[model samples]
Target: MRSLARCCARNERRRHDCKEYRRAVVTYYLGIDAGGSHCRCRLVDSDRQVIGQGESGPANARIGVEALKATLMFACNQAIAQAGLSEGDVARIDAGFGIAGIGRPGIKEQLAQLDFPFRSVRYETDAFIANLGAHQGADGAILVIGTGSIAHVRVDGRSFSIGGYGFPISDEGSGAALGLSAMRHALRALDGRTKPTPLSAAVTGRFDHDTTLAVAWMDQATPRDYASFAPLVMDYADAGDSIARSIVEDAALHVERFIEAVFERGAPRCALAGGLSHRMRPWLRQKTVERLVEPLGDPLDGALLLAGSP
Candidate 1:
């Protein structure tokens, strides 16, 4: 149940009838879509209007389990309050948790340790929800390239994914990876180890003209910090920085590998989502488009739909 301290005194919105029976039920659904930098919880009726919403901080597994629980609790409680519902009412509500941290070791165990008040719980990697949200229960694949990256294909409710492992060693074409590449280039330039580019200037200027400054920043910075610099890669690339352009091009290639993996599963349609989704679009290879997709809905909305459906 988390905490009722976040509850509201009045209902936020009215419920609607389920089309199947021509009967209006008081039931509602809750959806929590968590990320590396922010978490959002949405409440909706069977009809899928966003009746209530709440947001909190990052829930990435790399943040550790304690932080994950805290963030989920905070956002979920806010959503309960916003929906004008109480802890007890949630016992009848179905909830779907599409979280960034789910695929990590000990994640399922840690989540089971928590005591959320949902009547039922369906947990999955953020990538699955991203695909469902984008595909709307149809058979298709979705690539989510945010702080991390994963690609998933959905056929009738079953899902399969590729490459959502983590940073440096995995998660190709992700924001974290992009930033790491940018930083590598920045360091090389600073150490007189490589040719000059605006990226060096940008990185140096961003950190007060000292690449060493990033060491301390990195110590405090989560994956989000690395992902944050992903834009810098694009910025430099747009300005004709050869290294930056190369990074983006290489990233596009990495991203395609995931698409290819999904296509290998016989996926016919595909869509892209997350921070890097649109950014990588212009650079996407022609074959990737041969397996294109039109998104079904936003992830938050998809969460609500999953919760509401029987």
Candidate 2:
């Protein structure tokens, strides 16, 4: 009986030690979805269960490396704290970041070499991960229409992009573009060069209906600032304002062209993403509608998958 009792005690001790060892080897992951408007962080434990989430201000690459770093850290630390972990634990995590403007000249190289707190970090374009999440790692395409716009197609391990050149020159169907068009019409109305509609009056009124004042505002405005006026455009369009209708129709046509380009590239299906995706759906072409598929996940989910990559 004494020998049997001794064996039972020894087995219990071994089981406890084994559990401790397993715990010691467990890993954690962090996923960051950093866009022009905001930076978001999601933390998960070894089992892939979510621990916490946090958000902060914009982290666009154009904001430069130092500002981006500070916002990213702020968001990550918020998530870590919510997960009941100290900042020191950041060193033990693996991370993945999906950032806007990641494909611009030298942007990827700079981000890849950052002194991140994580043990390992991977980086991808926001559009790429949105494609990954939309199709759940399958062959598909995504049109991201936000403050800016871009389309990405993934097929058989190959990927391609369309539009998304940037503000003013590209991103034709994006919010910034729509807002810019609205402001232009408003300026023309103020100069008595165009028929002033309710939409133009309302838009110009924001700048006290003065051309000089509007120009002053534009001189310092960012993409997000322009995008802020998009909702007003949408509202005016919904109310059947002709000028607003024209701007929206033009944007819709651009979106149609983008989708047509995606299908032409051999994507099996496509999903629309970003702040304006759902709102723009009613304006999409029938052929584009036929090829649309519901996303299995979102960019954040794709980012998390990258975080756990071997």
Candidate 3:
């Protein structure tokens, strides 16, 4: 009986030690979704349980590497603090980032050189992560119309994309695009080249009807700056303003084209995502509207998947 008791005690000790070992070896992951307007971070444990969340300002790569880094770190530090973790724990965390402008030339290379506090780090375009989250890593496509626009599809382990070149060049269905259209119409109205509708008058009113002031604002405007006008355009459209309706309808046509292109690439499913998606949906053709699916997850979830968190 004494020998049996000893064996049972030893076995219990072994089990306790094993539990401690497992706890000590558990990993943590940080997922970041950085866009033209905001930076968001999520922290999770190895079991895929949320530890904390944080958000900060824009982290667009075009904003300059130092500023981008500052934005990212500010959000990350908040998440770490919320998780009750110290800065030292950063060295043990794996990180995944889905950032706007990452696909631009030299941006990825510049980011790769940063000394981030993580055990591992990976980067991908925001559109790619949105698609991954939308479909839960399954084969699918996503059309993102936010401050910028992009179409991305993944099929059979391969990825293809359309649009999202950037503001002024591409992003056809984006908020910035709508704002740009409004600005042009407003300018035309100011020059007496077009009839000044409520939309045009409202746009011009922002500059106090001064074309010179409008031009000066344009000279310093970034995509986010232009996107600020999108809500006003959308509001005017809903109120039956002809110029606003025209601008929205034109942008919707671009959205339709992007959706068709994604389907043409053999994506079995497609989702419309981003801040402007909800507003844009009501403007889409019925047939196009019927085809979009609700996303299964969000970009932060996709970023976590990229981090290889269990």
Candidate 4:
């Protein structure tokens, strides 16, 4: 019987096919969000199940290429082990990364040329991915106020950046911005140019009251140092200090202006994010409220979603 013989041949072929014979061939995609502070890596299956996860510290390229590579390897190896597979086990893989301090021109090219194991890889600024994560891939804007501040938005398949120009002269409406403002007030009071306030007392203690301290402090103050002073401004504001209230108010206005710029690009909604966003929301009055969008998930979780995308 030709039909019976053909069926037997088909069965034999299937039996001999390693791929077909394998009962469990798992597939996964990996997503990484790396920053100067920490890096998170996640692996997810088609179902969006978090099959694996890993974490490392300071994987930023600014820290050095060796540090970044080691961090990536450490995280990926942990994820691979958690998924019960080696890098070679996955049938198909895609990767997406959101990296901080990577907006420099040559960085993307460097990352593109990087040799890594994956089926496909896409790398973008953390701000872009944060924009995607906040809005669930919808076209909109995000206001990030943390140790630094930045406005990133996407519309018409293009990205625009506002603020986040580092600290002092730029980072308007950020913690650092407010801190610098506070320091200015303190210095004016110390120099007898303005009435002494609680801020003056606070600043003297912080700067150790060294002569010519303002000059040296300005030169040496990191973004985090300025951000650290943000709480002082908030405290004074709550205590009904006019100057502190105005400082925070100024921060709010700066953020609002940042959002307005993004909205001008045809973005229908804006999402407020970052450490300061939580407190900053209440500071936004009627206008910014109407334009803002609710976040879909946190950044690390967002990476997982991308990992599972078809």
Candidate 5:
């Protein structure tokens, strides 16, 4: 009878251990692509099946660490809720974050203090994630043109970045740059230093042709504020405005230069990924255009990969 009791006890202990093992093995994955304009999150199971997704406000590191954390938390909670997971489940998740301005001094250290309810976490720059996803982790290059511009390339396990400096002094082939140029042209036209076309007239109309008011607005304008006028430049260019066309063409040259530099560094493939990518495609040289390939995925996908990294 004692022997039978010992066998039953052993069976019970084995069952308990099995249950604990299963619980410990179950894992969830979260990927966050945190950009200047918005933060997006994706939750997936161990099998790589998406369970939920969410979005929130800007999480740019330049916006201040607290603000970035708030936006990231908002996105994370929404996704977790949508996945129908309990609060405790958050602690079982592994997460990866791809954030804009992460390369800025002290930003990485600042992110370390963020309270993420995950089993583990990884962080990478937005440009790296974009390039990673575009090529699906293979060696390649990506030129990202949005409110700002940056080029990233990976080749033979090494990474290189070019032209990611913020607006005014850099970010030459970016929406902010294009828009700023348009505003400058408008100012010149107002002073009779340049011929006023439909583009200049429309831009000047926003300030009632008052150079003083325009200058005042610009004095405190953020990059997003300047980028808001990019569509106007593109519209005017499409309408055959000479000044607008010149501005766009100039921007295209800068983009081409980025591509050439990337290829010279031995990247076997290249892609354009960002809000302005498709819009600028038509203006690229046929030879340059031919070298481009469709991105395999996006930054969010790259962020997911980071979650699985050691």
Candidate 6:
């Protein structure tokens, strides 16, 4: 009886060892969706099963290579730790990144020059990954309205984009643009050029209603700083603030135009994506709203797909 029990115990031990060996041999993939507002990291095994996820602050390429690298590493490390792995495992993991501002001149080259700790790495624009994830790499269009906004389409094996040229000059209908408009309205109210509403008053109140202080803040403000006011504008608009409503309406008009252009370019379906997509939807035209479809997946899924791509 004792001999039979020992044989059964040894068989169970072998099975456990085999299971651990199989797990150890499985390849890991890491996907990163780094955007203007935040960076997300996802770790998956060869079977595409998610093991861990991590998030960090903005990782826009415009922030510079070193800073972007640091942000990516922090998120990756967090994901690794969550998966019961260590930093050394990064070298064995394949990585894919969809990063904002990657289309700017020299940015891609700059990123390639960095010594990333991955078995291999693939890079694409954040919009690209979002579109890819939305349609599962099928032909479709996506308009991402986060801190910045851009429209991307994939049709007939060709890809194109509209807007997303960065803040101040481009990125129409973006959070930064909305905030900038709000700030301008607030300043105009202070100058008596426009009537004060709750929205403008709220904006000016942030600076104590002092024009000098507001100017100081603008002089040093980045796109993220301006974008911070977008939620406030949306809130006030929802509460029946006319000026805020106008601002959002105008922004939504631009978004609608982008969607129309995407369809005109031959995209069969479009997905509204990003942080502000929901807020902007109610303000868009019924025609535009009718054309929208739910995305099949998120940017992180696209990033993982890229990680396994040739």
- Candidate 2 Cα outliers beyond 4 Å, as residue runs: 1-22
TM-score of each: 0.86, 0.92, 0.92, 0.77, 0.90, 0.96
- Give the Å error, residue 35, model 5: 1.7
- What is the TM-score (0 to 1) of candidate 1? 0.86
lDDT of each: 0.78, 0.87, 0.92, 0.74, 0.88, 0.92
Candidate 3 per-residue lDDT over residues 1-310, each given as its tens digit: 9999999999999999998776567789999999998999999988889988999998888889889999999999999899987555667799999999888889999999999989999999888889888988999999999999999999988897789988999999899999999999999999999999998999999999999999999999989989999999999999999999999999999999999999998999999989999999999999898998999999898898888876
Q: Tell me the TM-score of model 6.
A: 0.96
lDDT of 5 at 48: 82
Clashes of 3: 0
Tens-place lDDT digits, model 1, residues 100-192: 868777888888777767777777777777777786767888888888888888865567878777776888898988888888888788788
Per-residue alpha-carbon lDDT of model 6 for 83-161, expressed as tens digits? Answer: 9875556667899899999998999999999998788999999999999999998999999999999999999999988
- Please write out the lDDT profile of model 2 over residues 1-310, one tens digit for every residue: 9999999999999999998776566688988888888888889888888898999998889998777888989998888889986555667799989988878899888876679878889989888888988987889999999989999999988987887878989988899999999999989988999999999999999988988899999999988889888888888898999999899889999998888899899988989999988888877777678878888888988888888742
Residue 159, candidate 4: alpha-carbon lDDT: 81
Show where candidate 4 strays beyond 4 Å: 1-24, 36-38, 52-93, 117-119, 211-220, 301-310
Q: List the residue pairs that clash in candidate 4.
A: 270-293
Candidate closest to the true structure, highest TM-score: 6
- Tell how far residue 29 is off in model 1, in angstroms: 0.4
TM value for model 3: 0.92
Residue 94 error, candidate 1, Å: 1.4
Regions of model 1 farther than 4 Å from truth: 1-25, 156-158, 308-310
